[model samples]
Structure formats: structure tokens, C-alpha cells
Target: MSKKVENLLRDICFRIKVKGREVLKEFPITPAQFDLMQKLYFAGEQTMTELSRMLGIAKSTTTGLVSRLENEGFVERKRRKNDKRIIIVVLTKKGEYVIDKVIFKRIEFVEEVLKDFDNNSKEVLVSLLEKLNNSVKRRGG
Candidate 1:
């Protein structure tokens, strides 16, 4: 891609990220909390070390986030049946409820943002995003 095209894409993505964070301020969860919940929701229970690695955050920071979520009744920590020394994080029913609402609102926001786009443009944008995501994953892996 040309420099101008790359710059334009970067700016658009940055704006979307900033706006999304701003919008989430009104919700019960912050962007980072939503990220953790989404990861746990899809990947199932994980150890603190594993979650920290997956999130690329330090264990101390992960601990704080986990603590806050637990206090909110959105997450629960449990000792493994086989390993008493290890603790895994699990999502509570409250977490599931909040996540469902958050996800639906997020999708709604995106839909509102794209309402001006024509059908063909919308399809092309979605296809390109999927292709780009897959390509990045393949290259990274």
C-alpha cells in the first residue's frame, strides 16, 4: 500500500479505538475489563500466568484486574482439582450477563457508525477485514 493509504487507514483505526473507549465509559465495564471477559468467555478457564501471558500484561497487573472483577462478582477463582497450588479464573453468571449486554451494544455501535455505507461497500469492508485478520494470524503464527 502507498504511504497515503497506510496513513489514512491508521488514522481511521485510531479514531475508532478512541471513540469505542469513550463510548464504553457509560457501560459497567471498561475496555480492558471487557477484553479480559471476552477472552475468558471464549477460551474457558485459564491460570493467572496464562491469562497474563495472553494479555501481555504483568502478573501483578493481571492480579489487580482479576481482583476487581471478582469483587464485582463477574469472575470467580478456583483451585484446580488436580493441582492445589494452581488457581484458574472462571466467569460467573453475572459476567455472562454483562458480557452479553456489552457485546450487543458494541455491535449496535458499529452498525450505527456504518449506517451510511452502501450494501456493497459494507460487504467489501467486512470481507477485507476478515481477510486481513486471517492473513495477520497466519503470518504471526
Candidate 2:
């Protein structure tokens, strides 16, 4: 039972990721950029080091990503007032706009996917997913 549940979860996660990538193709940013931007959007402004650590990428890679985002007007970097060396990356208004649109589209897609499910089923699914998420977080994922 555990193995089957694990396999199902893995497949669902993979399918969701693939679908997300397909949907993002209509947007201006790549998957990596979208991921970074999403993190910044939810987590607020963060230093390059913090972003790199959060994304599990190298500092140089984060720098390049930030540079591209800055050039595209999706993000901006500013030096900390107390320390000129620390650079914080923040999402711009344009970035916020893009994220909002992308998220709305994604939600719409999910709603379509779950359209067949009744309200009670959706409520149960939401509860179970939330429980699973909380468990994963508690385990320090």
C-alpha cells in the first residue's frame, strides 16, 4: 500500500511539473527563472546567497539568473544600506504582474483538471494534500 501510494504521488508530482512547464512556455520566463521569481515573490527580497541556498544552486548561477531577470525588468538588485556589499534581489511590479497572471492561469488549469470532481471530493483532496504538505514540512523537507 505504501509503495503504491508513493508511486502515485511521484507520478502526480511529475505530471504536475510537466504541465507547469508546458503552461509556462506561453510566458516570458523560463522554468528556472519562474522558480526563482516565485521564491522571491513569496519569500520577499533576499540576498544572492540566500536565494542560492534556497534554490540549491551556486552563487554564480544565481548571479546570472538575477542579471537576466534584472535586464528583463522582472527583478532589481539593491545594496543594503548598512552594508554596501550585500545585494538583495526584489521582484519589480512587472515581475509581480507576470507572476499573478501565471498563477491565475495555473489555477484555471487546475480547476479544469478537477472539474469532474464534486465539491466534497475537492474538499477531501484539499484536506489530504494539506495534511501531506504539513507532514513533509514537519519532516524538514
Candidate 3:
């Protein structure tokens, strides 16, 4: 039963990822760049070092990704007020818009897939998923 549940969750995540990539096709960004933007969007502004650590990539790679995002007007680098040497990467309005649109499209896809589910079933599913998510967090997953 647990194995079946795990497989179902994995398959659902894969489908969502495929849908996200399809949405990304309409944007002018790569998966890596989108990932960086998502991190910035959720975690707020971060230094290149912090981003590299969070993304598990090298500083040089983060720098390159930031450069491309900056060129595309999706993000900007600004020096900290107290320290001119510390550069923080900030997501621009364009970056936020991209993230918002991608998430909205993903939600739309999920809604379409669940259209046949009754309201009570949907509510119960949400409750179970929330419980599962809390359990995963408790396990440090």
C-alpha cells in the first residue's frame, strides 16, 4: 500500500513537471534559470554565494545564471547598503510574473484533471495530502 502510494505521488509529480516544462516553452528561460528564479521568488533576495549554496551549484555557475537573467530583465544585482562589496540578487517584476504564470498554469492543469472529483472527495484529498506533507516534514524530508 505504501509502495503504491509512493509510486502514485512520483507519477503525479512527473506529470506536473512535464506540464511546467511545457509552460516554460512559452518563456525565454532555461530550466536552470527558472529554478534560480523560483528560489529567488520564494526565498527573497540572496547573495550569489547563498544562491550557489541553495542551488547546490558553484559560484561561477550562479554568476553565469544571474548574468543571463539580468540580460533578460528578469533579475538585477544590487549592492548592500552597509557593504558595497556584497551583491544581492533581486527578482524583477518580470521574474515574478513568470513564476506566477507558471504556477497558475500548473494549477489550471490540476483543476482540469480533478474536474470530475466531487467537492467532498477533493476536500478529503487535500486533507490527506496536508497530513502526509506534515509527516514528511516531521521526518525531515
Candidate of highest lDDT: 3
For model 1, what is the error of residue 59's alpha carbon versus the real structure, in angstroms, after optimal superposition? 1.2
In candidate 2, list every pair of residues with a backbone clash: none
Clashes of each: 0, 0, 0
Better candidate number, 1 or 2, judged by TM-score: 2
- Candidate maximizing TM-score: 3
Residues 1-141, candidate 2, lDDT per residue (tens digit)? 989989999987676666656656666687889889999999999999999999999999999999998999999999988999988999999888878877776677788889999999999999999998899999998
Looking at candidate 3, what is the lDDT of residue 71?
A: 98
Candidates ranked by TM-score, best first?
3, 2, 1
TM-score of each candidate?
A: 0.76, 0.85, 0.92
Backbone clashes (count) for model 3: 0
Cα deviation at 20, candidate 2, in Å, is 3.8
1 or 3: which has the higher TM-score?
Answer: 3
Model 1: lDDT equals 0.82
lDDT of 1 at 116: 94
Please write out the lDDT profile of model 1 over residues 1-141, one tens digit for every residue: 669867987887776556555645655676777778878998999999989998999999888889988998889999999998999999999888766665665667788989999999999999998897797799994
| Model 3: how far residue 40 lies from native, Å | 0.7
RMSD of 2: 2.0
Question: CA lDDT of 116 in candidate 2?
Answer: 93
**Root-mean-square deviation of each candidate, in angstroms?**
2.9, 2.0, 1.4
